[model samples]
Target: MPQISAFDVVGPIMVGPSSSHTAGAVRLGLAARRILGEPVTHADIGLHGSFAATHWGHRTDVAILAGLLGMSMDDSRIPQAKELADAAGLQYAFQTVDLGDVHPNSVRMRVLGKENSIEVVGASVGGGRICIYEIDRFEVEIDGSYTVLLARYKDQPGVVADITRILASYGINIAFMKVSRKTRGSDALLVAETDDPIVDDVLELVRQLQGGIVARRLPRF
Candidate 1:
């Protein structure tokens, strides 16, 4: 099959006018909000190539800020995302960046709040699709398709199996799983589109591991 561009995707189940540019950006923003773990008071965003050049024409900025505000992708408020963000007292800015060799449609968002500050870099692939290329300066890939589980444990064997077993015991089927590490420590990001919502017990079981530091239940909105 031939390769596809941001404008070539087609679908109706979406909440926006386009999938690749709008929906995908919104998802990225929402995921950023999740990682920040708090309502951001201010933000500085940088867009690359297509995103920086045509974000206004395509509402990419709106979708992005709306995600930070925890708004739905389809919400009409997206059109007035900046205004709404200002009204909500969230500080923000947008700019274009040159990422010569990187993907054409890419963005780096910096957000700040009284509670914390965070930076996230990701891309809108197409058809309102998003992939979190990096978080908190950590390089990892996360497709916002399911409730994601972020785990931190020692660099030992059976860590992956232990996590899977906990989910399996609760009959939770992991739709996707990706693992990464940096020197003595390892990280696991599990995205599960389960038959049932992720209950507390299932989450607690995974948290029981020695190196398990955090587990998040991220549902698609």
Candidate 2:
């Protein structure tokens, strides 16, 4: 006989199956959707390593699609995600790729919306946990455990301070912060993990700042 835990369940609570293949994959897709902040009209998914090898058997493909549709890990609709996406007119395709030196259970999604597109790379680290490692071309580390603020802006001096100032005004405490850029004076990305939710006003103010292209708040799933 064997023991079972919550993480083994594909759904909620009771044990079901592999957490890395099901729940973790679901969370990865959900995180990417939250970062995009819009309905995905198309998704070009790249499955890597173990994810590619076992995707079909584990239902990882459907899991990712369900997450892109904004479904939770426990949502029974996950199994029917393909049909739902078709009904919603969301186009999607999946391909296998070799992402060198990455985790075995990794996926890269290029999600396209009517107005914008986002590329996210993440790894399912098992036990229903995941870590997002990149957004677009910017390297990041998001564990989906905290309220997060993500902003894209022109690479210039004082922008970081300006964004932080707005958060301070909202009385929100910072838990962590990271900045990534391609080159000097180019577009840059800022990711701030917070102790509390950011208000809409503060988010708007940050978006209004000079060089601000986009600002989005991601709540923990």
Candidate 3:
């Protein structure tokens, strides 16, 4: 079993009927927005397993919409999230889906902005903690425990080395890293959890590599 922390028992300070279904859902949405790194124009949310069944009872729907609007769990406007989203001109829809072999309290968000779009899948693993499992089509594990750098590039030789060199040049130390790809010679993803914040200059350098790269930072909550 996964080790539990003290906060897991005490729960997060949030507007909630339940931590897992409410606060956790909010965090998941925030994580999605963080990945996008811009204002969301549209979102398609899918709830699976237990979240689909008990979402309404816990107001998980509202919590998620509130999150897509960049509202934190403790935001005073959570109760008025729907109105706030409408005021911000954010469009959204929700549906129940069969996300096989996953945690019960899980959701998938397809978020779009004027300049970019992304898909994120995550699960509320009790307390107010969540684990993001997918980004775009790449499978990943992002729990918001630390600052992370997500890099997308062509699956080619020396790409990882090149990116790491940029991080080293910025005096950033990597704590953990994972790589995923659809197939050889296709696109690939690299997630690096860093001990120090990656500066924008380093990110710009990584993006300049190989003429086709996208890099974004995910800050810890």
Candidate 4:
């Protein structure tokens, strides 16, 4: 038998009628927002499978908007997310689309900021948990259970080692790390989940690395 945690038994503290649809949807949106690393000015959301079929009735749309606005799952404003988005100048639209061979509770979000943009694909697995599986065409596995450091760079020798060295120097323990590349010595995406939060100074150090394009920290959700 599989072990069960407190969260699995009691669910999450949230404004919700269902953990999978509402709470998980909120977290998915939040993950997208954090990965973008800037205020979301516009968002184009594509719902899939069960999410596409039942999102409106379950208020998954509202939950996603609340998260994009940086609201926690239990925020009282979740019910008014649409109005809030309009007031905050957040342009958004939602449509159903086939994401292909993924979880039923999946969604693809293309979020834009003033100077940056990101595309994220994620799914709400149950008990209010989520998994972010893709970011900007790079396959990843982020579960929002650890402080994550995302680095995008031109793939080259010693890049990963230097980043690990920096984290080690800061005494931050890495729980998991994955690097995905389009081709050898080409563009690469590194996903590092650390036991401790990555401070701003450390992030800046990583940002200054040769060939580093972007480095962002995503706090555990």
Candidates in order, TM-scores: namely 0.75, 0.92, 0.95, 0.96
* Candidate lDDT values, in order: 0.74, 0.88, 0.90, 0.92
lDDT of 2 by residue, 1-221 (tens): 68876655644441224688888898888898888889999999999999999998899999999899998788878889999999999899999999889999999999988877999999999788899998888999999889999999889999999999999989999999999899999989999999999888988999899874589878977
Q: Who is ahead in lDDT, 2 or 4?
A: 4
TM-score of candidate 2 relative to the true fold:
0.92
In terms of TM-score, how similar is model 4 to the real structure? 0.96
Clashing pairs in 3: none
**Model 2 bad stretches (over 4 Å):** 1-16
lDDT of 4 by residue, 1-221 (tens): 99988866775788888789998998899898888888899999999999999998889999999999888788888999999999999999999999999999999999999978989999999878899999988999999999999999998888899899999999999999999999998889999999999999889999898984689889998
Candidate 1 global CA lDDT score = 0.74
Better of 1 and 2 by lDDT: 2
Candidate 1 regions exceeding 4 Å error are 1-10, 13-19, 35-37, 112-118, 154-158, 186-196, 204-208
Residue 46 local lDDT, model 2:
97
**lDDT accuracy of residue 20 in candidate 2:** 89
For candidate 3, the clash count comes to 0
Task: State the lDDT of candidate 1 residue by residue for 1-221, as single tens digits.
Answer: 98975545444355666676788888788878876767888889999888888887778888999999987666667778788898999988888888567677788989887866767889888766688776655666676656666555566788778887888888777776766666554543434444456778877877777774466565544
Ranking by lDDT: 4, 3, 2, 1
